[model samples]
Target chain A: MAKAKLDKEKLLWMYRMMLLIRRFEERTAQMYGMQKIGGFCHLYIGQEAVGVGTVAAMKKGDYLISAYRDHGHILAMGTDPKPVMAELFGKATGVSKGKGGSMHLFDNEKGYMGGHGIVGGQIPLATGMAFAIRYKKSNQVVVCSFGEGAVHQGAFHESLNLAKLWNLPVVYLIENNRYGMGTPLERASAVWDLSQKACSYDMARATVDGMDVLQVNEAMKEAIERARQENQPTLIEARTYRFRGHSMSDPVHSHYRTKEEVEEQKERDPISSFQAYLLDKKILTKKMADTIEDEIKKEVMDAVKFAEESPLPSLESRFSDVYA
Target chain B: MAEITFREALNQAMAEEMQRDENVYLMGEEVGYYNGAYKVSQGLMEKFGASRVIDTPIAELGFAGVGIGSAMVGLRPIIEMMTFNFSILALDQIINNAAKLRYMSGGQFKIPIVFRGPGGSAHMLAAQHSQCLDPWFCNVPGLIVMTPSTPYDGKGMLKTAIRDDNPVIFIESESMYGFKGEVPEEEYLIPIGVGDIKRGGSDITLVAWNKMVHVAMEAAAILEKEDIEAEVIDPRTLKPLDEQMIVTSVEKTNRCVVIEEGWPYAGVGAEIAARISALAFDSLDAPILRVSSEDLPMPYAHNLEKEVLPSVDKVVRAAKKVLYI
Candidate 1:
């Protein structure tokens, strides 16, 4: 699969998003190891291209929602890490004003509905979001991202049925990271082929190379285009993987796979693959790319400072904002 | 004032509101063509047309979520849940999305959708169908749960709920639908969270709502024979609880009896009993009395259903016990 005709800036922006996500998660993993970040932390280590590349294809007006491993999705959707970290820190300055911790980052202003906790909970929600856009007659499509694990939820089936039936403008992104929490997807799922699930709903289904940003962007451009024009939902399985344990609680045990398997997947790492592609095409110089990395590192550091400096919500503030 | 049934009053409210707001639309199972399961939305299809009034497939969660999303984008949707029993299917949309959207969105969006229908036990309706979700929804913080009993309340409170800028779970009773009461033809609104004192007296404060309000009324009427002169208070909206009206009634009567068709252990009656006792502990003439539905699955037999649900006799007995008769 090939990417669309893109100017230097668009490619650079995509590069920056993938770089930002990689750096952010790297810092998060480091902090999590240091016991700075607590609770369920699922990293998008190998699946950077799926979220970043797809989000880059969508407009700012379009909606994007995803699952618990959503730090990358939010960053890829363009939320400042200060608010994102403040949220991870449970500070008031976070996206949900600190009410939603790491697992529930929401920035509706930027069209990122949320990082839902429950598996497949956001499926119905995303469909409903698309329904709203349809009801209002808006051209915006909702990019609803979920893991291969979520296909089993009743909500997933119900939402797919409804979204397909109504022909709502939404793109159902299945980030097949090869494992659900801890269990490898092949062992858990009855239908090992992920994109086949979409066929049942009569939706346009495709499998993109998750390790390649160009392929992801091309698939997303088509999916997003179909959603906008035809107002039909598309199911895309981005065959990807995670290079670490499900969370910080588990050790990097190889009970499920061998070291050789892990090593093989790492070779097709999305960030590195996209970086190589960009360089080989001569779209960017090494110095310019280094400048981008330096800028992101500086921004991540600044975001940490901003999060630390932000004030915590007051005790009495708990009673407020339950309803409008 | 003209006498109207609870169902008629509700229909009038929808008709009037639809006439008033251009953005408002009615949608649900049997809401249009079949005229609603309970006929609360009877003949709405002809009156409002298919665009304004819709009969959706039996997809409660799907449609409810649609209503929430529609509400997000400035469409005021009034969704009819055939009964409170079916609402369990849409609990995800009601609880997670509708209730929490505004708060979760950091006060960025307002959900102005009404999930309205009959609640509480109806005769011959089996275990799966017969149950009151008042106490269940009242426990939820974000929802404004309204259980309107009389024709006046059915008309007035629904108007308020439709106009309200939050997700209002408007609960009614199947038993109260045919019960006729005076309703004003002119436009009016009964504010949510306000308690109505139906019959005031000095002996005891009998707090109830929805169909149980009628039971309390019958009990109050019977208590008059014993010269008990019971005061009847209806806590129309449960979440806001009407503490001031309840406290005032308890302060004056100094005795209370709460009747509900939900299980006694942790029902609306429990909340009323606890709240009144906590507020008017010194003013009590006797310990608070509660007459509630039997704790079991409501059977299909009419006799068994009647025995399980609260009735006039139980309410009267509870009143007498509270008044130390």
Candidate 2:
């Protein structure tokens, strides 16, 4: 593929965003260990490129919905980290008012639809949002993201068929991290190549290296443009890896895979690789990289302090928001 | 007042709402050119265009979730399940997504959508197609369940449901589609959680809804011949039930009998019976009796199907049992 022609400022912005996610998740894991943050917390350690690249390709007013592993997506969309960290702390000032933990972050103002808990549940909802955009004659599009395991669900097949049949404006993004909890994708899926499954619906398909932010952004630009201009739906598979376990309960290297394999995968970490790319391109110097690191480290720590001091949700709030 | 069939009343409710709000649209199998599986949405495609009256593939979960997704972004969608039985395929979207999005999202999103269709035994649809699912939806916290018996209540209550800012399960009866009743030409909206007393009496209070309300009326007529006046009360909306109306009626008559078309176990009748017993224990002269469908899956044979459902004779017997005569 030809060189991505991104400017110096945009490339540096992507680097900072990826580093911020890495630091935020590291602190989140530490908080989980201290028992300050509870519930099923899934970390996005090695898959930062997919979330950052895809959100970079999107424009204002575009909507996004993702599965349980969604802290990276909302953060990539420029949501304040204080509220997100507070949400993980289950405090009243959180983005979802502490109602939704790590898996259910929602920032409606940014068009970040939700952090849905179910595997394939958000697929049809994204298709419906595209349908609404068409119904209202709006030019906006919707991006629906899910893990590779969600591809086996009925909601995935059903949604792709409707999106193609109606020519709805949507992009179905699959972040294939190679495992669904302890089970590998090869054992779970009938077809190893997930993009081939889109052929059943005759929808457009693309694949990108999830560790390379530029390649993923290039693919997303083309797919999102197709959706916005032609009202077509595309299924883009980003071959990525999650360095952490499925949740905090599971270890990084379990019986599912060996410890050496986890260490080897870390060598291709999205954040480190992107930093190398920026350095090789002469767009970022060692001094600039150190400055970005220090800024992000302070920001992550302040978020931790904000979350630690935040109050738990009031008891009366439990009954509110159940209707309307 | 204009006399119309139950189907026409429902059609008017959709058409008027669609005319009032551009965000309102209808989607389902056979809803567009097919004119709806049961013709409840007849002529909608022609009036509102295909964009508004959408016909979808036979994927209940897909279209149901699509309606909810649209509702999340400020669209009022009336999703028709070919039958309430088919809605079982989409229960996850309804129960988990639509019902929980508001609370889980901390009120950032409100799902103003409706899942409406005919429920309960209709002909010999067998065990699969024939079911009364009001209790299933009523059991959920975020959903509002409505079962209107007459054309007037059908039109008025559906309009109310469409305009309300909450997810609604509006269940209609297949057998009552052609049933005629008086409905005003002017616009009207019935508030949710209010009960209507269809008949007034002093001997016993008969509680029922949807098709069972008619059966309760028939039972009341039979009890009237024996000098035992029975008051028939229909709680139009099941979830936010009008407990005050039923409690007051039971206090006046001092006797109660609840009837329903669903199975006896955990049915809506059971909930109402429990509520009346709890709230009107001091006023009760006798224990409350419930007449419900036999605790079995609907059988295909005509005789067995009739035997499994709640009938006027069964309701009359339950009322007489409560009256101790």
Candidate 3:
């Protein structure tokens, strides 16, 4: 409760968390390229602000749920890197005991609902989580995250309608990174402004600059506050971009997007922008930032080593976790 | 104990579970004010109110997924899909999300939810809304598929499905909703993953479920008249099938015939038939016969409708085939 403001320490913590997420992703992408990690890997590089900002607004009783680009949310919510990395390595020590790699990370202890694989699959699930919070008459809210792509799924619309009708304490966030795999946002959706789509359900909705941590945090704070106080749901469309391809399997050339466009968006990088804000505000010295980077780099390296040493789940494991 | 109709018994099971636990709730298309399309959720909206006895949109997959999510947190939600045919829209949520969550999350999440509704052919409703989906879902792991024929079984099995820590598919019958039968008034629960024997004999084993259970009983009666004698078995729960009951019956009779309203190829009957063939291989006096719906969409006409679904006549014919009579 003390010093919750974006002061030097808090900003530093944010940077450290985002840095950890970024390092984990960068090396994870490299690992994927090296064939160390298997299955679909959706990097959370450009969209770190969305996870970091929104999770900051969440409390102990609050819950979080998201699509496959979920490593960042889990890490930010305080899940150990070893288990998550082990999950990536398909090892038994993983969060999902190696059965759910990349896309199905779950940490119930940390209030992280899941890293659901199917698009828009978690929307109704998250709505139900909020329903539970309200049903129990608790003050907790749920942050249900989905990509702009999920707007096409029927669950998305259905959940929104129910949440609005019931006045459940839920925050429906759309990480509009402007692309759905190979399809750009323009081609994928007729309505370019995703937040406005919520108006049809008569739900409170807005859009924010997803690359700016401050803007996203401010938006999330308002949404979370309204959800808890008024028992109303909020929909936020954070307009952002992905620094990498959709997945490791996707080639840069197969899509309609150009390298120039990607490089141009890199100029508005969230991490770099936050760093600039810190330097201007004199929140942290350049040397201190460098030390934090070194520490995070070591953590990522240690995680990679532990994952390498971790044992793979046995063939018998295919039957073990079905019950418990 | 007071006797209740199948419809009243189903209502009692849900009402009792909801009264006993704060987490139990029922939601469906017409389960609220309209008092259940088949009256299974009768007076529930009054007892539990509109919030818990929720009447949702016609979107089956959407509401079904919501029920899965609600169950994931702490509530036990029974999502009613007016009939099993309507469950097709929500199949992905039921099969993919609900059925796979517990295993997919590696024991982190439990979908203690129920997708309950009437199943099998429902008399002249035509192709799209009358065919059964038990076979499609029984194939999926992490789910307990159930079809209750008797009022007592309906009351007991539904209560069990509500309390289970995994997703359960509870099938009812539009044809048997109003059927009168004795149901225990006391709070009773039948364990899931276990089958039940409705009638017992020794000449042959006739296994069926839902409306087919009646067919099995009818076949048993016909065999009784012919002095052939048959054991009528209903594997109430489909997924964690009661192979023991089927095997034991086949051992006693040395012959078996499985009846299902689903199509002949790859129906729930096929799975039980194969298991019977394996378990009762040495004990069998004749081959295992399957009495199943013809592999086609149900027609709107009454005669075609009767012919399309597995009936008492089919069960009798199938029993003769197994007995070589």
Docking class of 3: medium
Better of 1 and 3 by DockQ: 3
Instruction: Give model 3's DockQ, 2 decimals.
Output: 0.69
- The RMSD (Cα, Å) of candidate 1 is 1.9
Q: lDDT tens digits, residues B250-287, model 2?
A: 99999999888888889898899899889989999999
- A1-324 per-residue lDDT for model 2 (tens digits): 226678888788889999999999999999999998999999988999999999988999999999989899999989999999999999998999999999999999999999999889999999999999999999999999999999999999999999999999999999999999999998898888899989999999998899889999998999999999999999999999999999999999889988898889998888887788788888899999999999999999999999989999999999999987
Q: What is the DockQ of each candidate?
A: 0.52, 0.89, 0.69
- Write candidate 1's Cα lDDT for B108-176 as tens digits: 678899999988888798898888878888888789999888899889999999999999999988878
Weakest 10 consecutive residues of candidate 1 chain A by summed lDDT: A245-254
lDDT of 1 by residue, A1-324 (tens): 355477878888888888888888888888777776678887777888899879878986998989888899988888998888877766778787777777777777788877777787778778877877776688999999999898987778878888898889999999998877668887788987788988898999999888888788888988999999999999999998888777667655467777788888899888777777788888877998899999999998888778778888777767777867
**Segments in model 1 whose C-alpha atoms lie over 4 Å from true places:** A1-4, A254-259
Interface RMSD of each: 2.1, 0.6, 1.4
CA shift at A39, candidate 3, in angstroms? Answer: 0.8
lDDT of 3 by residue, B1-325 (tens): 6767899989999999999898999999999999999999999999999878998878787789888888888789989989888888887788778887777677888788988989878878999888888889888878888889999999999999889888888989898988988876567788876888888788999888888888888778988999988888888988889999889989999988888888888888889988988877999998888878889988899988887777777788888887888
Report the TM-score of chain B alone for all candidates.
0.97, 0.99, 0.97
Q: Work out candidate 2's RMSD over C-alphas.
A: 1.0
How well does candidate 1 score on lDDT at residue A252?
Answer: 53
